[model samples]
Target: MVVLKLQSAQFFTAPCEIRSRKRGNGQKFSRIIRCGIAEASGEPAPLGQKTKYNDGPFEKVFMTLFAKKMEKYANSKEQTKKIGWWDFLYDYERFVDASKRVMQGKNRMQQQLVVREVLLSMLPPGAPAQFRKLFPPTKWACEFNASITVPFFQWLVGPSEVVEVEVNGIKQRSGVHIKKCRYLENSGCVGMCVNMCKIPTQDFFTNEFGLPLTMNPNFEDMSCEMIYGQVPPPFEEDPVSKQPCYKDICSMSNPSSSLCPKLLA
Candidate 1:
């Protein structure tokens, strides 16, 4: 007989004694399994039978991996901030250069170049130059149609027809509207949107002109995603009228005629 002891939830259990069975070779073998939580005093608290193994190596490996990942995450975050200014400048310069190159060409190539130029020109001036430098002309041009030109014109012209609705005795203003989109190609979209909306002008650091010219990267595609998302699909039914709402506000109404003469023309 062999005695095996284990700790319970709040107390120790009586030793469980088991007699070993003899094998054909006249040797006796016995197996004992216990399950429970360890007690406060560092004793095993058994609830039932369980398998056990050494976990020290696994714990050490996990800790090492976790530490490495954390270090990498911190390093990447720092790198992003450090590269932000340079990336913005590069994108701005590339966009300007590409536009010039496209303008000097002709035919289908010229049409594509014009579209690219228009889209790039629409972006905020502080986009990361690194990202712009990476874009192929085809992608840059296509992105402008899908994300930039469409969305900006949509917002400038308004999303829905203005119909007066009264909230109380006095007339109240309410209409379906698209909020300005933020750009996130580089650092993040919120920062770009703040600059576009000119929110930072309230503080002296930004000044009445907002960010200084040196800090400006002139990202023309900052609002691409924003405009793309807000600009209703050409095939989608209008929410208010249940009619096809394919017409772009800017193109149809010319709301941004004064602001974007190049586009209007």
Candidate 2:
């Protein structure tokens, strides 16, 4: 058996202000703002272990079953290559089809067992039994904030090797700075612009299950530039007076040509 271990440390923080779109009333707008600091350190275990199985006939049965299901989708050589052996077994389509069969009073538990067997057949050869423990479901949530003084190395010149990456307002300790850019022309947005962004998760779910579902924006409806800044003003918004907040900055019609002044230096 081969084992590998890894460890790393990192720090990040951001201050965010969320503004809600105004209702019909003329009252002043109320908003919630959050600021916080976050840091973490951890060591990671090696990826996976090897094991052996004695059930040869059962393995062949699962391989045949999964291949039959994949035949419908595997048209070209490129498609076959893209659908790896493991995916042929548990691809979302198979899951939904089996679910429907179960709901229709077919061999429910037995069909599920077939799916599990197919997955087991796809595991890398000699994988350890303990590998099953690694498949447990998990969830995560986090928040952060912070500020800083200066470092000693700013004095050095002549093509500095260090790279700085900043996200939201927090900068990374090292590596080339990566700034988010707008997806659409004339839109001062980065990462993802709600109007232009297309997430594949919803399509994957809908296509496999024949269900119509759309993943919508979670926050208030606002221009992308407000959430993620970009180089020049991408596009113009409607007039300020007509908008929920009657301030110049709130208007989408008039976009400022000024680049982020901080980046200029």
Best by lDDT: 1
Report clashes for each candidate as comma-separated counts.
Answer: 24, 13
- Model 2, range 217-237, lDDT digits (tens) per residue? 211222111111111121232
Which of the numbered candidates is closest to the native, going by highest TM-score?
Answer: 2
163-226 in candidate 1: lDDT tens per residue?
2222224332222222212112212222222222212211211221221111111233222222
What TM-score would each prediction reach against the true structure? Answer: 0.16, 0.17
